[model samples]
Target chain A: MSIEHRDDTGDRFGMWLFLYTEVILFSGLFILYAMALAKFPQQYAEASHKLNIYFGSINTIVLLTSSLTIALAVSAIQMGRVKHCLNLCWVTVALAILFLVNKYFEWSAEISHGIYPGSEQLAEMGEGVTSFFNLYYFTAGLHGLHVLIGASLIGVVAVLTAKGKVTSDRYTLLENSALYWHLVDLVWIFLFPLYYLIL
Target chain B: MTEHKHEPVPYRTFIQIWLALLVLTGVTIAVSRVNLGALNVWVALAVASVKSSLVIFYFMHLRQESRLFKICLLVMLVILAIFIGMTFIDVLYR
Candidate 1:
């Protein structure tokens, strides 16, 4: 049996195709969010105002910085700087964890205030506010899940990178991981303003 | 088969783009604080679009990717736009 060789360009093309599907999936949710906003403009504004802009902005910066670190990790490996690449990957993972930590705190603060979905406080609120929190939880929760998956993916790549399996000559895995990390950051870019800023 | 060789993007470029993204995030927050009425949403979204574009173009190296990838992205975005537009038609009128 002949072993099929890897094709870097083809691999990247496939990754991009998968990414397109992800975009569409998230777009569906964004559509729901937009429709809800349109339906309850006043409520959305009021609900959005309840979000802490400082926390949101800090998380945005964290994700953006992580994106940069991951990008640099790819470049580092491309240049055969394995140690630098590993360091950058670890930094990216750390930043992702930090983002989640901040999110946990933010959500806990809201939940303690009974602003979470299905809470009595949210139940007392009108349908618009209910819709706002629902969309907020769904969108941000999905994004957080992606972050976890992406970080773990990068973590595996980092291990492979340390084992010399993902070398400069064969860094497609690292490159693809960076792409996924960037997509996570890209989603947050839209989520940040929609949920935190657009009051 | 000859291995494809990619030009390593400079570290400085990534830093610069990161700085730009942070600045844009700050700008969006500041802009949102103002009472722009209906245009507020538009402005926030526009700023987000710019930030995402920068991430895609530089951080994701979409600019350096093949034309096919770019076309795929454009098409996906067009489809998303159509979906949103049609949904808005229903949402706004009904």
Candidate 2:
């Protein structure tokens, strides 16, 4: 078998294991979210409405574009275009930075406005609503942590590629890391609607 | 001709997948606007499932991958679905 086959098998197994951990990690927050939402359906709905859809939408678009960039990077590698692959990896990193910047602004604004989990704004909303806010912060905060980790993983791959550590045949790091990045993006795709667009 | 020449890479497939994702995003947003009551969760999850399948199939290259890998992934998701389903039952009932 070719190197790509072995590489693919190894990476797929590794990625699946990584994804299992991720499933467990996110399951914690999902359980809390489900319980909180069930206890305070209307309050959770109202709290979700307070979120800024414009920022959420822009972040989604950015993530989608990053996914495109990373996919193209993989394609470039398979086609034996090393430089193009590196360039696309950098583009994906840039988009991730854009996403973090947007998230920071959104979080800071929400915090300053006292929309934090147990702040007065939440207290005024009632205990059930306060619990919803609590879950929101916990879940979104956990997701943000994953985003940071994913960005760092991809950023390391980009830097390595830039330094010539990766080539067309030796790009498993990029491929696997990109798989992780896309999973992070996938989680947010569901999260955006659950947290931002619910009626 | 070589026995294993690579086909021209399907960049268009990626583009179409991206466009489909955007459409699904719109569908999710619109579906949320409708108050389906208990069914709203199913609608959202269904749209998400479609969006996820698109990414897994095209973006992640699962479609062109080995059958073993695809089967393993499906098994993983099935297990996840079972866990989520059981949790929701407890939440909804209790």
Candidate 3:
């Protein structure tokens, strides 16, 4: 019986294809956002003013740095620097957690002010404000979920890397996970301006 | 199967890219405060598109990927653009 070997290129190709589908999924929400903005430009702009750009900007830098760390981790493994790769993976996870922590505080502030999705105050503000919060919560919440998933995937890959299961020759898991992490960062790149800065 | 050689990118390049992204974030924040009227959204989106391209080309190593992968990504983006464009047509006219 002949055993088939693993194809790293094919593996990465599959990941990219899946990412394209994810892009299309998010594009649907973006279209909805654009339509809402066009319909109620003034109200959307006013609602956007309520967002704290400082927090959004900090999260952007945090995610961008994490993307670099994850990319460097992939480079480290490809060059047989397993320890370095593991350390970078840990840093990526820490940054992702920091992003979520910032998101928590930001959301807490908004919810405290009764500006969350489905809150009486937001709903009373009319359709534009209500739709703005709804899209804001949904898109950012979805991206946050991706952050948690990417961080956990990186965490598991880091353990495997430490155990030498993912070396220079067999590091597709690490590479694929890094790609996913970058996608999370990419999503946030658009989300930041769309939600926080476009007022 | 042809084995594609994996090159180890220099650590300095990653740091440089990170620094560039940070600077761009600062730029976006600073520009948002200037109140460019309706052009504000376009400027912000353009900056974001640049930032995303940097991540895609460098951090994600799309630049090093095979031509097939690049073509697939391009097609996907074109489709997304069409979707956004069609929606804008309806929204803008109505």
Candidate 4:
């Protein structure tokens, strides 16, 4: 074996670097949102009122719980509790599915009301509300994609753990997946307040 | 250089953080209902900052990361904040 070696800390550092990029990527969209809201504050608040806060709040809880489960899964693996780790990961995955299912219903309800980007019904609502819903769909859609990817990453990590590829002593994959999961939660933490809690 | 192992975070700590997050969520909801007018948005964002901090420091284990990691995170956040802050400044001034 070569004397040079890789360590988890370095791997985690790289992961954080990548996450910083993701943060910048989303910040670009948020800047757009801030400007749009600034230009049409009243219309933005009116548009925000249309969003179902109950749905948003429930989804928030679901995501927060998933974050906990995944964090626990990482802890379980660190303690060498493979089976427990597996179970927690699956639970996290299930919570992700629950969040998506809840989101689907939420989206369907809004869509049935003729609320989507570029829909004829949306265009009739005037420009500001249209922009609001359009941004809503875009941000929420991008975030949903992240949720899907994070769940799949965790799922793959769980399988690797089961096969002995990842272990108590070597679990960079698990830790990184947990970090990604938490990032998803991080984004939603902002989204819930900005979109759903309009005063 | 010698390698070091990470200490596994306890299950109870995770649970505690989870509870704290839920409570913060509830607090934001209650604050929003109080009709703080123009201040509502800032207040909402401030609470969100707190909530995200909890996730980063605890859930993502940034609290235990090396100083370099923390510095990098602060740098990234500061850069983003500058971008966001400048935009708000232009909006307010124009």
Best candidate (score: DockQ): 4
Interface RMSD of 2: 2.7
lDDT tens digits, residue span B1-94, model 1? 8655779999999999999998998899899889989899899889989998999999988888879989999999999999999989887787
- Per-candidate TM-scores read 0.97, 0.90, 0.97, 0.97
Q: Which pairs in model 4 have colliding backbones?
A: none
Q: How many pairs of residues collide in each model?
A: 0, 0, 0, 0
All candidates: CA RMSD (Å): 1.4, 3.5, 1.3, 1.3
**Candidate 3's error at A31, in angstroms?**
0.8
Candidate 1 vs candidate 3, DockQ winner? 1
Candidate 1 lDDT over residue span A1-199, tens digit each: 9997878988988998898898999989989988888778999999998999889988998999999999999999989999999999999999999999999999999999899888888978889999999989999999999999999999999999999999988899999989999999989999999999865
Supply fnat for every model shown.
0.88, 0.50, 0.79, 0.91
* DockQ of predictions, in order shown: 0.84, 0.50, 0.80, 0.86
RMSD of candidate 3 to the true fold?
Answer: 1.3
Ranked by DockQ from best down, the candidates are 4, 1, 3, 2
Q: All models: lDDT?
A: 0.92, 0.80, 0.89, 0.92
In terms of docking quality, model 1 is high
lDDT of 4 by residue, B1-94 (tens): 5667778999999999999999999999999999888899899899899989999999998888889999999899899999899988987898
In model 3, the clashing pairs are none
Higher-DockQ candidate of 1 and 4: 4
